[model samples]
Target: MSNQIIVTTGIYDAIKETLRRKKVSIHEEKRLATELRNARQVLRRDLPADIVTVERKVTLKDHTLDFEHEYIFVSSTREKLKKNKYSILSDIALAVVGYKVGDIIDWPFKGGNRKIEILKVEAWEE
Candidate 1:
């Protein structure tokens, strides 16, 4: 993944609030801080359709395990215990958000760093 990331203003504001109101791991805090610094905030309509953001459905492939996962990235308040919904504060979401389909990154999963590929991005529907 590139050093720079693009995010909608809403998601950007949510992230900033999350950082202030919630306690996260030091690594996550730093990672998010860096992302905020390098982020290019834009209006939702101005964002590209392929980019991943909160409320979007994303399909990801784990290169090392050869596994596929699907998730709907949601804001913290909107997150649920459902299997397919992931909070933006989650490690996977944090690593993938602001990125677009086809981007790959090495993320620190529960086991260790895994090579993950963003396969698809779908807009959310209410």
Candidate 2:
């Protein structure tokens, strides 16, 4: 079961914001990216291997726009948990955007690979 990975602009903003608050230096961006990448690789390595698929869709409601994608979790590493643990899945989700369904993606980590999916998306004007 091959999963689909969804990436959106908002997720990028969140990562940037989080990193900014943490005072991640410009040089650290590469390192952070690498860590994120490594995390995904770790997940793939530690989790069960499966082929998950994904679908992307756009929605309009009440003058609002939203995007959503769905995929399946094949590996135990894909499972969502509340506790903050250092894992590929978690790293990818935090670093990358729209990580919902299941899709294999390459993270910037030194040499990291991730399987992620974009579960949902929503856009609103402030």
Best by lDDT: 1
Return the clash pairs for model 1, or none: none
The Cα error of candidate 2 at residue 100, in Å, is 5.6
Q: Per-candidate TM vs. native?
A: 0.84, 0.27
Question: Candidate 2 lDDT, tens digit per residue, 1-126?
Answer: 223223333333444565767644454476455443433322322332231211112121211113333222112343433422222223333433333223333444323433333333322111
True-vs-predicted CA distance for residue 76, candidate 1, Å: 2.4
Error of 1 at 19 (Å): 2.7
RMSD of 2: 15.4
Model 2 residue 83 CA deviation (Å) reads 5.9
Count of steric clashes across candidates, in order? 0, 17
In Å, residue 71's CA in model 2 sits off its true spot by 13
Model 1 TM-score relative to the real fold: 0.84
